[model samples]
Each structure stands twice: as structure tokens, then as C-alpha cells.
Target: MPQRSSTFNPHDPVTLQRMQSARSIHSEIMGCQLRKKKVLELLPPFGAGKDYPPQPPDIETYIVEFDGADDPMHPQNWTVRKKLRVMTVLGFATFVVAWGSSIFSPAIFVISEVFHISTVTAILAISLYVLGFASGPLVWGPLSELYGRRPPTLISTFTSAVFHMGVARSDDLASIMICRFFAGFFGASCLAVVPASFADIFGNKTRGMAIAIFATCVFIGPLIAPVVGGFIVTSYLGWRWTAYLTSIMGFSSFALVVYFMDETYPPQVLVEKAQFLRRETDNWCILARQEQSKFELSDLLEHNISRPLKMLFTEPILFLITLYTAFIYGILYLLLEAYPIIFYEGYGMAFQISELPYLGVVVGQIFGGAMVVAFEPMTYKRIVANGGRPIPEIRLIPTMIGSMLFTIGMFWLTWSGAYHRHVHWIVPTISGIFTGMGLISIFLSALNYIVESYLMFAASAVAANTFLRSGFGAGFPLFAGAMFKNLGVQWAGTLIGCIALILVPVPVLFYLYGKRLRTMSNYAPT
Candidate 1:
């Protein structure tokens, strides 16, 4: 047996407890006396109790190559001003992407006239932009993981802006359609990038509020675009000016991003820095062992590209929520399209006056946005109290109320219009306010919960949701007029309302069984 000190040194504590009874006494003695001593001496000297150097505490504390701050790649340590600027740039870019959905609302008649296309076909142009929104995120979501956010954002914004410029100068329907499609393709990049940007900028505790703010901006953009477009179109600025204005907004957003946006992708930044350090010092060991070895480009490509699609296909929570969201989004666009015909044709109103109905959408969004911000923290607290399992279903409270309001509003508006009741045009408009408010609340709550449930893959989850939603947004408007004409106003709205009603239980069910549901779900984060 080998003898050992019974007492431990506080400053240089023994790592191994017993060497002999541990079955490796001789080897341990050699290691401690010879190998360990040599290794300790080879390491830099540790501090004594007194006369300490004024070095950074982190430097002396951690044995890694650098403290977190020393790594310039960490986004958290960035200046507050710099972070805010990046957020602003992303927010503006998001606004541009969202604006595309409603910018053409006032220009529908103009589009019909210029293209000599039927009203339904012309409406598809609006749908196509949203379709681009739906699909763009999936492509961009994967690409960002592969290439980093900056490249995709830059390329998408620049290209989308250029397409809008082309739209402004387009001669015929073919050119305009081509420009719009390209614009949507580029515009979709922002949708993919914005939420990811939020994830990078805000901590988990504060992220929900930040996301709500982003959602507010996103929702507000579409609502306000129509109002702006109405004035632009009514002023004889021509529908092309709408494209021009949106292009200008996109360009300004691009410049802000170029100047302010710092790289938030840790892997990409570290990889780049590692390559630089390897070049400068020619030391392969400069980075931590975990990051020293580069991953295979093929593996990264496969994972990045395939993962979102895999999750989209496999995740039941993501799939169902996406379906519901798409239906909601479709109904929204359907309602937008319906407003023109419902209020103007059915009631006999002027074009500028007809655009006033959009006020309902705006007012509703304001109310919903406020409610989300106010109620979310309470819900979060309640869920925590119920155990750590916060179910996605609880979020349905707002959605259910909103959906019922949506249906009632639609029914009331339709019946009022059909009967030529005592109410002025404002009556239906007021009902529209209720519908818009309810729809936005439900849509936003569903989206927020999905994002939370799929935190690891938030962009991809949202992309899937956006795809379904945008598909509806694009397709619904095309049938709005025909549906109204064929089914009659009351029945058309009632049918859509009934469809919305079926989804009411979805949120409630999820709220109760969400933990179990998420447990069974493959795509949901554990």
C-alpha cells in the first residue's frame, strides 16, 4: 500500500481520492508524483492568496482558450445600440415582406383593367404573393442554416427590391406577373430571417415579448398597406406607384441591414474565425476541441436542407396548427376580397369609401396585439404553476373567442347586407372589426404557441405554417366573388364561419393534452 495525505489542499485539491485501494496504487503514484507534477508545472502558475494580478476574473477562472466575451463571435456581448439596429433592420424587412400581401388590395380593379383579366384571375396575383410568402420561408429557412442569415437576407431583399422596380416599370401583364413572382420569392426571405433574428437577439425569458412586438409590426404592415394603397390609387398615383413605394421601403431596409446587421449565426462565425486563426497562427488547436474539427459539407447540407421538411412532414402539432393557421389566413384574404364586393357591389358604394372597411382589420389587430402582450405572461405563469408542462392548447382561449366572433361577424354582416337593414355600411364594418380582431388573436396565439413548442426549429415550423396559410391566402381570394355569387352572401359567409368553428376545439384540446401530445410528437423539442 502507498501512503497518502489525509488532509486535502484547498488551493490544489487532489483529483483522485485513494490510489491503492482504488486498485492502481503504483500507476497512480507515478502519475501523481511524476506525470501530474510535470503537467502542473507545464501549466501557467496558479494564484497565491495575496498579490494577485489585476487580470480579468474570467481569464483566471476559466481554462478555456477564451472567456465568452473574448470570443467576438458571441452575439450576447454586442453593444445594445448594435443589437437594436439589427432588430430594426429585420423588423423593416419583415414589414416589407408582409406589405406584399395587402399592397395590391386597392389596386385590384386597376390590375383587372390593365391585364384585361377577369377579377378572379387578377385576384390570384394577390394570392401568388402570399403563396410566395408561404413557400419562400421553407427555402430560405434551410438556406440560412447552410449559408448564414446575412447572405440570404441580402440577396433576398436586393432581389425582391429589384423585382418591385421591374414591377413599377412593367409594360404588360406578363412582365408584371413575372416581377410579382420574383418579388414574392425574394420577399419571403425576410419572413424566414426575422424570427431567427429575434431568437438571436433576445433571451428566452424576454423572447416572447420581443416576438409579440415583431408580430405587431408584421400584422400592422398588411393592415396599413391597404390604407396607404387606397390613397395612392385614389390619387391617380397609379397602381405602379404602390410597387415603387414598397421597393423604396425594401431598399432603405437593405441599406440599414448592410450597415448594422452583425452575424448572429454562431457556427458560421466560429468556422470563419477558425479558418482565419488557422491561417494566421497555423495552429489547428486554436479553437476548442469540439469546434476544431470541421463538419462535412455534405452532412451539413443534408441536415440543413432536409430537417425542416422532415419536421414539417412528421410533426403532428406543427402539421395541425399549420392547417388551422392556413385556414385562418385563407379566410382573412377571402374576407379582404369579399369586403370590396360585399360592401361596394351589394351596398353600392364608391371605391375610396369601400376601402374604409379595412379599418376593421386594423382595429382588430390592435386589440389582439394588446391582448397577446397582456395575457401571455399570465398564461406563462399559470402554466408554470400547473407543473413545468405548458400545453399548446391553453393558448386557444383567445382563438376560440376570436373564431366565434369571426363567424358571428360574418353572419351578421352577410344577413344585414342581404336584408338591407336599418344599419349603415358602418354596421357591417363594425362587425368586420370584431371578425378581424378575433381572427388575428387566434392566428397569432396559435403561431406563438407553435413557435414555442418548436423552439429549436421555429423558423421551419413557421415556414410550414406560412406555406399553408399563404396557400389559403392566395387561393381564397380567387374564389371570393364566385362563392359570394353562387352561394349568396349569408350562406357563403355562414359556410366559411362553420368551417372556422370546427377548429375551435383544437386549441382547447391542445391546452389540456399538450404536454402528452408534445411528448408523442417527434418534431417538438423535448
Candidate 2:
């Protein structure tokens, strides 16, 4: 081989070609920056000595980007303690709002007696409260997208507290119902936003556990509320104290959130970061959240409100899951109506003793939540590791299990609670465990499936879920007394159980055909 020459030629074609390639890359990178307005701090400095020299332009770029995996600004990269704090606040807030709904169940009879209204009329408070849950998400979900999660969370929680206090102070039934509805409407912010917040911070592996925990609190709150409310209603403090208690709890939670929870929405954080960078670096090219910041009131109503409704009707998967979840939710509240009459008339128990039966459901939910937390993540991680994508079908397995349990539980509750043959109350209450197990398992699975499938439109998908389930939850109580009275406990419960049996095939069919359905879907993640 000839000896290599040490001198480099300045006019070499190869060197010229390399220079041209570098310029191309530089232009593409600059174009990316201008289009997204993202500050890509990871890029090499454009200096004379740099290998891929930046092209000379009117403005020099020193865009701020996340520092690899260690960027502190990234919510996922925050300290584990910080993530836990966020979870705690969100979980507690969800519990408080849920409690606000059912705490009034024990008070319903009291309100009826005081106002000389019928039982069904009194139940409108609970029903309307749940209706607020359904409606609020249509508005709040989009607001979270438009603003930051933190602002929506704080504003909603504070307004809910104010309304809770309004309920406490109200003297008339109309005023109480109005206050309760508005309280629930505002407090539903957590239902709409917190799940997405978890998605913002957690990877698939950890999100399963987080969802299980959050969902447990949600299911458990309403279950436990009757117990607490039962005691409060009978106490010297009376029914209004329940609202006062909720107000105090809500306000306390609001303060905790204000102090601890930082903004978690990635786009919002990026926008703030861009604003800071623009101020620091004096660059006008960075435009953080330009699109979101421009949304006006009309735009918010149309996109956030109308879009979810459109999706609700148009998206088949969302529609089916919502219907299924709503049916189970309706039955759960129906049980509340059925339980009071059964215990009061059959066992001669006061409202406090009657509410004791709800604990069984609470225990079952805890069991269901624990099971989901324990094993689902292991299997989910295994599936992902074995070359499977995070398909929505992964969640359907639990829904099947839950549906079967729900069916059995309803029939069991029928035999134990509705029968004329004298049976101990513990038997029916024990059956409530199955009800909780099935209800919560289905809820967790469906929720996880929706979020995983609708990653891009998770908020809108959740709004649909909220709308249907809460709608059922609200209406079911109104008619539950009538159903139980007309059909008797056995047939009434059997009817619900039969419906649940029919729906068992839903998740099963979805498990088999979900991918194909997703292929046809406009919103589902491919």
C-alpha cells in the first residue's frame, strides 16, 4: 500500500459533499424548531469548531431541551417522593368528591321527613349530584387540555367547597339540591383530570398500579360515605353537618393541592418553559402552546363539550363500555335504595345500622383493587416484554371476571335480601362483597382499556365514561324504590343480574375482536 498523505486538500469533492450534508441537517433541525417552537437544548452548539456546524442565520439558536433522561422539569424524572405527593393529593380529592355524593344517602330520609317530600323525590338530590358528575366532565376535561391540570384541579376543588358550604347553609330543599348539584359538578374535576395526570407521569409498567390505587379510593369513597353519613345523620350534629364536613375536607384538600401539586400537563409545562427561555435568551421564534392559548369561550364549549358528546354517540367501543359501566353503576346505587327499605322494614334497623351493609362492598372493592395491583401489572409487563403491544384487549380479561362476579352477586343479594324466608342480614351483606369485587374490577379494567386505547384522546374518552356511568348512577336511585316495590327484591335484583349476564359477553367479544374494532375506530390508538 502506498503511504498515506498527511496533507488535507481544501478543494476535495468529498469534503464539499460532507459540508452540503451538514447544511441540510442544520436546515432541517432549524425547520423543526420553528414548526414546534420547541427549545432543543440537546443539539450541539453551532460554533466554528463544532463537527456539524450550524448554518449562519439572523438569530442564533440555543433552545432549551430536556437533558436526556435526567431532566428535572420532566414530571416522570422528578423524585419518586414528588410523584407520590401528587398521587396522594389527587386520590384524596377524588375520595372527597365521591363522598359528597353518597354522604347524603343516609340523609335522604331525613330530608324527606323534614320537607314532607316522597322518598323518590328526596333521592333526586343523590341522582342530581351524580348527574353533575356526568355533565361536569364534558366541560372540565377540555379545560384541562386548554389550561393546565393544576389550575382546573384547584379551581374546581375550591368551587366545590364553596358549594358544599352553600348546601350546609341552605334552608330550603330547592336550595339544597341546587347547591349539591353545583358542588358535584365542580368537584368532578378530579374524575376527569387525575387519570390523565397519571398518564403524564407514569410509564405503562407503573400506571397499572397507580390506576388500581386511584380507582379503589373512588369506589371505596361512596361505599364508606353511607357509613359515615349514617352516624352523622343520627347524631346531634344532624344531616347538614355532612355538608359542613365535606366543605372542610374539600377546602383542606384544595389547600394541600395548591401547596404541593405543580402543573403536570406536558404542553402547559413546555409552554411555561418556552416563555422562560424567550425571556432569558431573547428569542422570538419560540411559541409554546400557541394553539391552546388561543381557544376562546366558544371554542372551549364546542371542542370540549360538543366533541365528547359526538364521540359518545359515534365511537362504538366507548359507547359500549359506557353502557356497561353505567348499567353496573346504576345497579350499585339501586342497591343503596333497596338496602334502606330492606333493613328498616325487615330487621327494624335504624339508618345507621342499615348503612352497615355497605362495608361489605367496600371490603370487596379493596380486595379487587389489591388483586389488580398485585398481578395485573406482572402479566401486563410480561405481555409487553414478549413482543405484544399495549392493546385494549389486555384489559378485557378482568372485565369478564368482573361481569361474572357482578351477575352472581346480584342473584345472591336477591336470595339473601329479598326473600321472605327469615335469613340473617349478614348473609346478604356478605353477598355485597361479590358486588363490590365485580363492580370495581370491571371499572378498573374498562378505564385502563379506554386510556390505553384512546391515548391521544384520553380526556374525551374519559368524558364519555363519566357521562354515561354517572347518568346511570343518578337515575337508578330514583327508580330503584319503584323497581324493588313493584318487582319485589328477587325479580328486581334478578333483572339487574340478568342484564349483567347479558353484558358478560361484551368484554369477551371485545377481547376477541377489539383490534378489528380499533381498526375501524376514528379515535382509538392503532
Candidate 3:
């Protein structure tokens, strides 16, 4: 104390060293706070940030330096295990969403009876559900990109569950129908968010598996939902159980999402941190470029709002694939509605037993999922063998094989039902298996090619496809009753098969000339 000197230099080496260390610590603390802010926003509650400072350059520096993964913040660079967990959870959420939409189809009769309504109006529930699916994704897909995947997903799912509960409790058809539409509107959140999420987590090489898993579930969900719902309704539980069961599934999915799924949207994560840093440090400069743009809200809304229509109009590959997929989906839905009428009413198969025919679509979907999984590794190997660059046409190999079987399934199911043959019904059921397999295979390939050709706008492109696909899915059933009534199952299915036959060459054409077409087109991703 007595040796203390007033003349002491603050720039003395010891003092300077301490000062430097203090600044360094302060900067680090600031960064940690920023990162924690992002972690809270981007990750669910369980993945809270540890105290350790991020061991890299600033967020922007890392974003650029690591090329993409530097953003240790990126959901894409999330450890393989973490990413897989997210996909599984999100995939299941997707399952529940589609499950809710179609779970009530077979229960339509029960609903009709309960509401004392015409069968046609009861079926409105199904159509309105699909209609919600058709429209909701247009907004949700882009919004998730702007906001994080979590908030929209949680909100939508929770809202959907609440609405589904309403559907269960409603006493009248109009109330139920309104509730059903909103339920689907909320659930459609899963579809819009899942694909974009997959693109966020997986890279080009392994995306096929991610896509396969997701697309397989989306396609199979409806098929399985009706099967389970049919059994539930026929088991004396009644149609309302369909709504309750779906709500339970949805709530369970929400729990899983809250636990497992992390934010995959890059912009949202950055903006989250930007928001925190700006608030805490009171330094506006702390905001990231994306956050600094005051137009973000408007841009986000516009991007989400415009994408579906934009992709539909601008991209030929997206347009064509959407058209093709729409027809396939439409027919699939039509068959879902008509099968009960044809096999149960006309052929006298018991409702419970008649559902066994759906085993065909289920079997086919399993095969299709396998084909897609198999196709991916094979294509990757071939590309690696051929000096590492993949040809767009390579994707068509599975499509080619699947389409043939698809055509066969259509003919088999159509004619077998039309002739009213007593061949154990397993014949058409097996055909359904093949059709499902083929349809999914082709669908995966088509979607992959479209996304590859439209990376930045993949959400929009998919939105366009979903719009058409669900539109057709919703409307197709309405026509099924009339078509079968006038044309009979054989001619009706044959007519659809003839259309599919026309479509068979589309993939082949794309396979052979796809690259050339994408290369020449203005917006086809070249």
C-alpha cells in the first residue's frame, strides 16, 4: 500500500496484458451470449448452449469461412446423429398430419349416419381436409424458412390437434366440416415444413434416403390411416374415435417434436442471435445482414406467399412433375373412395375384410420405398465410378422399372374389380401393392429431379406440386362415384391406366434428355 505510485503507467506490460485479456474475455462473453440466444431460438429447450465460447471466428466469419458448416449454428452441419433424430421426429409429425387427413375416409359412412346427412356431404369432410392440405403448404413452407421450423410446426400441430378435438365433439356436419378444414390447415404445416427441413439437414448425396423416408411416409400415411380408421370404426368405437385417435397421435408427435426436432432454417437461427445481441449490447451493428434488412417481414411473407404460384408458372420441370404427380395422386385418392363402394357394396365383401385389399397399396409402397433406397446407392456408385459427376438421367433407372409395374397394378385393380371376379380379392390387393411401390418410386425420382433443378426455390416448387397433387387428391374422389357408376370399375380403372400409360414416357424422356432440358431452360437449375 505504501509503495503505490501515482505515476504508474497504465500501458505497463503487466497492465497492458491484463487489459488485452479483459477485452478478449469481454468479446468472448458477448459471443457466448449471442450464441446462447441463437441456441434458445433455433434448438428446442433440451439443446440449450453450454457455457463454452464458440471456438471459431464470428458468426458471419464462420458462415463464410467454413463455406457452409462454419455456421456451427447450421442445422445442416448438425452431427449425423442429431440430424437423424430430427428427421425421425419430423417424419413422424408428417405421418400424423397425413394420418389425420385421411384417417376419416372409411369412417365417412359412420359420419353420414351420425349427422343424418347425405353420403355426398359427409364426403365433404374428406375433400375439405385435402383442400386444407392443398392450400396450407403454400404459406407454411416459406414461413418456416423465414421463421424457424419449430415455432410454425409447433403452432400448426397444436392448432391442428385442438381443431381435431373440435371435429370429434361437433354435433353437426357443418361444424365438423369447418373443424376438419381448419384441422387440415394446421396439420398441413407438417408437409410444408418437412421437405424443406430435409433439404436443410441432408446434402445432395444422401438426400435421396431422406426424401425416400419422407415421401414414403407421406404416401403411405393416407393408405394406412384409412385401414386403421376402418378397423377402429367397425370395431364399434364409432367415427368420432377417428378424430380422437388422430388428435392423440398429433399430440404425441408434438411432444416428440418439442423434444427432438431442432431448427433447420439458417436465416431464422441467425436472426434469432442478431435479435439477442442487438438487444443486450444495445449495438445495432450486432445484427446480422439478414436481420438488418427491415424488409425481412414483408419479404418473408411474400416469399412464402408467392413461391407456390411462382414455381408453378416459372419452372417447366416443376410444372410437368407436378402435373404428372397430380394425376397419380388424384387416381390414388379416387381409388381410396371407390374401393369401398365397389368391393363392399357391389361385390358384397365385408367392410372389415374388404380393407384387406389395401394391403396391395401398402405392399407396393414398401417395394417402392425399397426401390428408392436401392436406387440411390446404385446411382451414387455409378456416378463415382464414372469420375464423380452424376448425370441427371441416372435417376430415371428406378422410375423406368417402377412405372411398368404401376401400369400393371392399375389394370389389375381396375379389371379385377370391374369384372366382379371372385378371385380372392387378393389379386387386386397385390396389384395395389405394386401400384403403391411404383407410384412412390416415380414420385421420389421426380421430386428429386425437380428439387435438384430448383434448389433455391425448392420449397416453392414443391408447394406447386403439392397444390396440384392435393387438389386432384381432393377432387378425384368426388368423381370416383360417378365414374364407376357410368363406366364400371374395369373401364374406369382402364381409362385411368391409359392416362398413366401416356405418362410413363415422361420420366424416360426426362431421363434421356433431362439434363439437356434443364441446361437449356432459364430457371431449371443449371
Task: Give each model a TM-score.
Answer: 0.80, 0.86, 0.83
Highest lDDT, which number?
Answer: 2
Report the alpha-carbon TM-score of model 2 versus the true structure. 0.86
lDDT of 1 by residue, 1-526 (tens): 3433344332331112211111231121112222455555776655675553564444312212222322334554566687778888888888887887788778888888877888777776687787788778878876665456788898888889998899889888878777887788788887766776676555434555667667767677777788788888888688889999999988988887788787775445555665667667665445422232233456444555555667767887777777887887777777777777777787788776777777877787778767766777777776577554444565667776777766677777777766544667777777867777777787778876886786545666777776677778788888888998899887898898788677678777766777776888755644
Question: What residue runs in model 3 are displaced by over 4 Å at the alpha carbon?
Answer: 1-72, 272-284, 296-304, 382-393, 520-524
CA RMSD of each candidate after superposition = 11.8, 9.7, 11.2
Can you give the lDDT of residue 372 in candidate 1? 66
Candidate 1 stretches with Cα past 4 Å from truth are 1-83, 272-284, 287-302, 380-396
By descending TM-score, how would the candidates be arranged? 2, 3, 1
Estimate, for each residue in 25-115, the C-alpha lDDT of model 3 and write its tens digit: 2232122223445546765443365464444456444221112223345565678889889999989998988888788988888877876
lDDT of each: 0.70, 0.79, 0.74
Which of the two, 2 or 3, has more TM-score?
2
Deviation in angstroms for 381 in model 1?
Answer: 3.0
Return whichever of 1 and 3 wins on lDDT.
Answer: 3
